[model samples]
Target: MQAGSPNTRQSSSPASKGGSARRRTPRSRNRAPQSPSAPKPSLFDQVGVTAVDPAPFDQLGLPKALVGELTKAGLTEAFPIQAATIPDALAGSDVLGRARTGSGKTLAFGLPMLADLHGTSARPLHPRALVLVPTRELATQVTDSLKPMAKALGLYVREIVGGMSFARQADMLRRGVDLVVATPGRLNDHVRQGTCVLSAVERTALDEADQMADMGFLPQIRELLNHVPAGGQRLLFSATLDGDVDRLVREYMSDPVVHSLTPSAASVDSMDHHQLDIAAEDKHDVLARIAARDGRTILFVRTKHNADRLTRKLRSVGVHAGALHGGKAQNARTRILEEFRRGSTTALVATNVAARGIHVDDVSLVVHVEPPADPKDYLHRAGRTARAGATGTVVTLVTDDQRRAFRAMAGKAGVKPTATKVSPQGANLARLTGAREPSGVAVVEPKAETNRNPGSGGTRRGNPRGRTGAPRNGGGPRGEAKRGEAKRGARRA
Candidate 1:
């Protein structure tokens, strides 16, 4: 979710120089020819490259009301994944779709659900369709995508997730609901409490099913399923089908039609990946300048504390940076995401919380403030940009100490970014970033190890002096949340 309801039209456009959905392709023809000196695609260019079939939704028989809503919302063409999967889903078959992040998976299933579901008044109040996602951000995102179509059909959809009032959710359920988009944990909680019932659900979807299993939400997912009858429609869309996720197909779904579009780790072809080799001293300065650039930039940090600290540091230096992470209160996350979407905050510092399922158009830059742990994470992080056939940039900042791990991530991600040195305030950086003058932030080195506090998670004799910095707002790095914490939050799933 890009921080606001779908009803908010202005929220659809990003602060980046990239124009509205309509202005995008048509305006491409008006651009000046690229000079021969322009940087060519690096090895990373071919990593996520695949020829996607961009077709209109009418080919899939999407109802007119939904089509009209999409047209009014500015999505005139169906994304590749949407074009591939919508037909089967609309036909009421159990559809299994495989598409990477940013390939528009939300509508791949949502459109069919909206078209098939009867309104709340006709359906007798309980959910007729259920969308189960791995994260709260995703639950909110999927809900946002379905909202307009649901309203057009005179149906009601509620987002049930953790950190919100369960009583409020119960109240909403009591009032009546046609569709429920939820994280498995919270929905299971409702199921356990008898506050919400899935017995009436006719269509069920597990969006990002692979992630649900990876985040260890399979137990709750299974428990949630126990509340719904086994014969209902099942639609599972994921980047891949394996392990417990594959078992879900065996156990839960009937004879399903699978649609696999791109391989996992498919970074968009149009994205440019650059690896900057900088000393620890100059990394922050380079990052601050990048964030202050003209377009929407998403910087990924390793820990929540670092995310908060970096946001504060960027703000102090006059960059409008906002932090997004799991530890944030739901409303705070909402506000931060809203600010970013509205262009009031052009730079968003986040962890994996914004990685999957969340869609914010025209994110022209994705900066890995800290290295991702694996290729999948790298793909998910980079997928935030270069969406819908638009060009974007992915930069990884690696200091000397992190070189080996960075290389490992590169090899795993199958993206070999060209190494280069970035001056703190150089014309090269400005040209790529669309900024003319240097930002005011100064480059600073990591302070030397010192016994600042004997009580502060005492350091080892020779290793780094501090515990790994947390992400901004006292959270650890973006993707550094422990498996246990992700699991607990998976309860909210």
Candidate 2:
């Protein structure tokens, strides 16, 4: 969730559209017909596979630096959304992309931003590309995605969000930035304060447009766009484009090229869904067993307290799980996310916090330990799985009492999860899940202390440069002195 937002939007899950029944193919009866010694297809035959058809960078005419950065980050291959939208985005034309979350939308817009932006000796703090996200974590994550590519292109990216120190964000802006990834509310704050200007913005992207509308940010989003030039390129990407999002597209985008990957409701069809019936008393044990069999698992609960409590229970049972909810401090939220991304934590026991904007690779499963109130929440929760075309599993742990609500959520999301009884130890979890023991557990040694500091760079020792710590003798640190002196020194120079 974005920080300081009072009213949370109920999710619009696809289950109500009646697609769930098709996904509940039982494991026992799911075996395919045996082929008589037919040869398997080569790597090239796979669509959306690692085999390259036309690279996004190549087709989009992006700078070599951006492609190099993506290659270094193991993203040489483009997802379908990236391939479909990059060409138009790079061509400086408006684009409307319909793709589910985790479909590589960041790069679809980011690559072109890096390519088209012209850096100056007098760097403009004003953004060349403005990416409006729905959540603060997403702002940070999108900024992270832009950083390497920006650095490779000798550009700078800034993050503007709420809950973080405004002074810090202002300082980043003062230093000058090439691109800005921001949430609507905070971005509006900066705009109203004159800390940011959109006059120079040549490209703008509204990611998760449906979610933003659902969150009631459409007015703020429109207010933001009012500051940008009408002639500038606009890109809107979302899972479903209805209501306000469609209006935004019509109002802002001009002759935009449209790319829809699939029907939004069917996006999760590639994912495996399961409904586990576990006794209330055995819930913790079954969750631990399922979490233990994972690559990375995101477990969802209904309440902030449950999110925190379950996190501890998972940890006590020897599963590395972290908690995320609105109750956590910003620093703690960032740390838990870093732990999950770095593989230090195999599972994240979260409320609706991870429902959006937290992206890590190889997240193979999502478990809804508690049913959400509505279908939109279910869609956002289920969106955690089946990311970037990677197959994943979503299991909802439902007791008899919660069956009706679970069924309702499933119906709205159009997913029929396989129903099974989970024994106390999750005896049937492995077979039902088709998950082998997580690969790194054997090779990864346990650490004595948990490295939960986000700025620590996943190291036991805090920031190697000691930037995150206070200065000695109530004085500024080395970098701080230089930073403080730069403005003064520049005037003299």
Candidate 3:
């Protein structure tokens, strides 16, 4: 008998000890057993509860002004996630949204929050709505996505994140912002400094909550959420929900309506996964050949140093490559992303910093130089390409030693890759990346002086050797003697 079965439990009861157990007839025992019933679908699959068919945004009851803004931007229909969550969110219900990255989640939450706060007055230093993201890039992207709609509603939105001037953020807070999009760390900094307050916030949204939990930001997230009024509306969205995310739901949200457009660990249907086994020595050449292709590619590395090193190597082979990581300054990071977007830099080498929030159009390929440590990381890294209905290729290069680990990672990530052993010059490689031979000539690195002083060629007019000469530390022996005499005169006095 199956353990814990009702029949087994009943057989063990004292009532069965009165000779009743032996009274079973052979005919009854031979009777046909009943067939088991089919299992019920999970809550996530019960779309009839909250899922709505895709329709025009007008049917979702969005304000005319907001719809006008979306119309101007040529967004007429709603995505699945938007269609599923917008109605409930607009009705002031706490929402738990489960959808992958690049699924129009920004608008899923942004529109309702804006609509709710539309005409409501915000006090200085206290915003009526808050959207917390895990990275500065995400904060910027969310702001860009919502700014136009917020402006149409006459609501001001400001971004608060680290790696930028805090004073400017404080000034914006001081001047009063209706909505604030921020990373948890920077928001906590402002909160502790008393430059911003959340008492007035009536709506709060957490995008990519799973990533925040993975990055150990849950404590900070909890603390920030605590600042909002206890009864304020809360919306949490993530690609996967578990661990600290569950704790968050229990502690903060009150009977939230959960909506999931995809399975908890669903992989993108438009992305093609491949595993290329190549010799270690030929990896760089293979990467170079792939990166030199005509379209945009993002190469994921394990560390910031590796990102920089690979970018330099790719550029040395005459590929227009840029590096992105936490090590870069905010403006430099922004510039690199802009260049990538505008096709000035066709290839980008980056750490996982770009995995979650960096969205660029027509990214044709994603190369994993090092396999991600976790399945979620793999999904996010692969998500950079094949976004929003676009088909793309994801290749993970596995050396002999890494083959086992790569296989395990792929298994955990629910990916069935097309594996092949390839050489740097293999025809498969060429076909996979639209490969082309890289320019043999090394790219010239511009001199620092030329960048610092555009036309000044490492020289300045104040130099004692003249305009075309190198700068002198001290004018000469006389200049040194004058400095020494001045020090002696001060001591003697």
Highest TM-score, which number?
Answer: 3
- Model 1 lDDT per residue over 49-148, tens place: 2334667765557667888888889988988777766665655556666776777888888887777764336343377789999888888888887898
lDDT of 1 at 3: 12
TM-score of 2: 0.74
True lDDT of residue 82, candidate 1: 78
Best by lDDT: 3
Give the winner by TM-score: 1 or 2: 1
Runs in model 2 with CA error above 4 Å?
Answer: 1-56, 119-125, 292-294, 433-493
Write the number of the candidate with greater lDDT, choosing between 1 and 3: 3
Of candidates 2 and 1, the better by lDDT: 1
lDDT of 3 by residue, 228-332 (tens): 887788888877656578678667766565777777556457788999989999999999998999999999998767887898898899998998776555666
lDDT of 1 at 334: 75
The clash count of every prediction, one per candidate, is 29, 18, 0
Give each model's whole-structure lDDT. Answer: 0.69, 0.66, 0.75
In model 1, where do residues sit more than 4 Å from their true spots?
1-55, 119-125, 434-487
